[model samples]
Target: MKNRIFILSILASLGFLSSCSDSYLQEDYSDPTLISYDESTIRTNQDLQKFIRGLYSRLGTSSFSGDYFTYQELTGDLGFVSARNSGYFINTNAENHLVVDGGASSGIWSSLYNTISNANLILSYEGKVPDNPNGGVTSKALFAHAKVIRAYNYLALLGLFSPNYGEGDQSLGVPYSTTYNIEAKLPRETVPKVVDNVIADLTSSLADFESDNASAIFTNNNSFNANAIKLLLARTYLYKKDYQKAIQFADQVIDLGGELVGGGTNTGNTTFSTIFTILGENNPEILFQIEYNNIIPSNNNLQAYWGTSGAYKQNFMAKAFWDDFPSTDVRKSNVAWYQNNATTYPDDPKPINVKKYLNGPRDVILLRKTEAFFIKAEAQYHINPATAFTTLKNWVTTHRDQAYSKSLTGTAVLDEILRQKGFEFFLEGMRFTDMKRNNKAIVKVQKANNVPLGEIPVGDRRFIWPIPLSEIQTNPNIKQAPNY
Candidate 1:
């Protein structure tokens, strides 16, 4: 099968060319801007930093910005788009949930690949940056940062598209594009190979950061730095099923000591509301986020999709998920609200609206310390159940449900951790992957106006998304996901 691979032209990366025209092989090209910039365009640290910022800009607008989270939430058991409105039909089913081309889909596959391709281009110029005689550290740091971006993008692709690393592993993996060769039709590597590549990139990048003794190259958690890198390590290890390694890295972050959920607030009933009230680039808990500079002209999709005052509104909580929370659970109070025939879905019987994203132009959190603690808890459960339950109890009791006391042991302990993660992360986009990772059957048995629409069993093919049709048409080596 052939999959379409969109490659940005070299001139376009230099910020000159606008769009490509047909019949490019005529050889009488008259684009002057493309001819001006050469190897010297990115020789210094300033030039490299500017290019890096451009890569970050791509991240801001990509499907992962807020669209990815929205799609994930609706498809998961925690939330569902109303069946009354055919407009949200794509989000209602597994088949059209996310796509590589066109209309209402998340459009993540292409957006991520574009960013990856650009990172590859920037990395190709690593040698061009002059080495500092004092230590050659600045040039090395720049190169390492580029690797971090590449690794981050690749991991995002793997998480959504490819199967889990262990038993759920699909032999096929997304193409690892590490070069700026547009004509290159790279085949999908195996799942292990993809994981290895990400680990290799992060490992090398961490080494470079240590060599320069640079703990942080960027501030405000807006860019990838040493701290963010460690968080990524913890998350990656968790996905890879390396419980011990995941715990080790999570410990590093925990020991470093920062606020739990973005600010130095007590983890009581007020924790969720307080932290979200002031969420921004400088939030202490955020290890990495997509930042918006201005508060007034915010283009963040979260504000529109989840924001209470914003125009668009179709997303609502699954009642079963809401009912799972204790009556006094602060997360339930802070994260969602009962909107009775208010706007959008009038047919919904007091449908729950997510309130976490009410204010925007706020930073879109990609990683936070709260998640680190949860990762540690889950990892510990697999290693030592007693200690894991203790950790889980302490964290949840203090931060989440104040009255929460459940003597969970064995498999129940793991279930509790997953459940806590669902409540904490909520719509920040971890639900689908978490369910899949644990091989949990998605039982959306809630009666939405007395309708039983969702009940996906384990080993169901719909759980895995189809490879975008465009990809299958252009890249001859690409294979669609099994049972797609």
Candidate 2:
């Protein structure tokens, strides 16, 4: 059972050459920019820094994190592709005839594996690279950083390709490789094993940071720090249904001076819209993001795909969904009606475009503090319903809707928490995963025609993406999702 692994070749031309086994070079590579490298290229602390930068570059690409959100949005129940524009993800939007060979699965799979392999290469230098005069970054710190990247990417792979955690001991999880062994053949680990591995890597990383205060070496939100790893651990536990652990980590983040962007008020200059407006700039709420600038602009089609004007406007919000938002809600400003132009379908009438990513060359936020509040609220619901109700009500009243006074109880408290989180994270790509983990049906409405696209029932095989056909053809060990 040999599974194909796409190992990245460091940019030798850029003073870094991260290479693996010679046999891997002979094989067909998924990314053209990926060339073979020599392990000796990474000798100094500077070289190690360059190598980590390379990993971030790969992860920041549209094919990986960018499309990650896009594909989920297309498949999720939130919105649909506009018929008035370019034919992007229309079939996905309609939930029609999804095949293993199609969708964003292949690119995402290759990109993530490439990142994991490169992270492994960095981890290989754990005890070798010495602290340099330039920065006090220790080899131990670099190794911990690699572990966080590898573990986080593995978690992302699981969310896309595998069933929800705790499904069963036999439920298949994606194949995970810890070492830089391109020739190694591995079978899928169980879902629980994969979750355990993610937790172990994060826990180990946390210990390394806590022992020597190594997290101080990396201060940017783009890099993984103690809080970022904590957030990821919180999310993993939340998915695994370990409520106590989830609340534990979530609280650690919240209590550590984590504040919302708008400060829970709409009267100030720093309102909810400031999160998107100050994309590349620092925001207190953002724990982790993929930074982009004029030198190296984001390739993510978020701005183009969701833009109200121009040829690339393919996706828009459902009017019914938009109408449901209270007029006083601060988050409702994220959508605006598309003014008719030569390119638009005039008959369509009042199509709304998502404003979150309209500004290009901005940072793609992956984790933030707002999610911590939601995680704690939901986790509390399972443990103490009364406490969860207060948390939910307070969060909504303070941050989102100033006029929100819903008297929710029991299951309704949990439902409102999810609904508010969905609205908070709209177009940021948390909706589909939220629906899947909670076993909620995907109820999509057509954006153009206002037609109900039919509900994808809970636990439908379609919810689980098929293993890419390339992997199937190349790796005898790989197992496709059932009924794919």
Candidate 3:
């Protein structure tokens, strides 16, 4: 039975259960010949737990957890592909070669949908499984956990594949599904409708937490919990431009504790960079992270792409973006010039690479408590600008820099808040989405010319990634993004 369950996990991870075809949109999990055992295999809550672990592993894959960050940063202005390195993301750095069949588009699209399909299957066994033998993992908790994963994947898909929520209500959102119907032909939901669905899933999950007697047992930094759901709600509301609700949910996260991981002086062993090395094991600031180790190895290429000692050394921080940081800033420790003689050009100066993931097997952080502070600051700016300024000032003083005494009012306050956020989450994959949400243009920094490349104007068709050719070919109801 144990061997059968392990085989089930392996098959699910390889997409055998999600789809027999190339496109995830055509998933057919009900086909009897595909699996040796029926739904009876998942007869216990422990069995459901094992199955859900597969979904978490899928989330940790290169397509979803690893390259997704690289795609976001390279496409944005903060990072650029190095001429002295491998050919990874070269076209993406130049903002060219984004087509329907491109790997960047298809990889993220397929992986997310596959995970969602698995979550739907897990949610189907809500009441059928018996109570966990270990206790504290009720069917209700398991169902809520599945809902959070499903909603998170949908939210990620919406951010990458659809137009920004601030674009317009009628903008197209990717197809969202909640059932395991093999023959279902799902169409794209509008941005507004998708947001509504995501919110409904999260809200329903919160209710499940409230009703579950063993809810606290499941709420941890490694898995979905009430606070993680609240953080997602805050992010969704922030993207939707609903500031009041954003602030409310963000405050709930803040009130729950887990202070930011830096002090006024970053002189000690515990600094802002410690957040990455610790892997959230005992870290209070981490709300949730996708952990990777020897047993369950990480599929992300962040180490190879960003680390100076990486195998590929494919990307580096833009000089212009690096100059924005002050020497006093502790976050500067993560950015260093590539010094290896083998990779560096003797004539050309060394380029700066992010050192956040210098060693392999680093965990991918999905949500942090520090984000709540930023969200509250930004959301407060919409409601009360002066309060927002104070909020930003206090956070910077307490955590980032004690000498950070910039007195600004009006929109400048909002600008500084975003700038700090950009610094805080440089390689963690928040910059591109934040830029899109604010309708900001991408200003590429040209290395040879030392001048800014022409900005990719707001609302450019390229800003929204193309729907993969596979999905377009298989699903007639789904339409491609405009102009792609």
lDDT of 2 by residue, 93-118 (tens): 77763578866677788888877877
User: Relative to the true structure, how large is the alpha-carbon lDDT of every model?
Assistant: 0.66, 0.71, 0.71
| Tens digits of per-residue lDDT for model 1, 1-484 | 0111122233233242111321222233255334333456676765565566556666666776776787666667776555443354333433344444443323677788877877887888877788555453377787787798889888877776777886665576788867876667777778778888898899888888767744333445667777678878888888888989989888888877754532235454324454444443465677777655443223455666552455566556665566677766666644433322334554344456666656665667788888888889888887888889999898877766678888988988888888888867877878877887778887753324444456667887656666777777778887777775
Better of 1 and 3 by TM-score: 3
- Local lDDT at 242 for model 3: 93
Error of 1 at 483 (Å): 1.8
In terms of lDDT, model 1 sits at 0.66
How much is the lDDT of residue 341 in candidate 3? 32
lDDT of 2 at 214: 59
Local error of candidate 3 at 423, Å? Answer: 0.9
Candidate 3: tens digits of C-alpha lDDT, residues 130-175: 8867676677777777888888888888887888875653558888
Candidate that would win on TM-score: 2
Model 1 worst lDDT run, 10 consecutive residues = 1-10
Candidate 3 residue runs with Cα over 4 Å from true position: 1-37, 169-171, 210-220, 263-271, 278-280, 333-350, 446-454
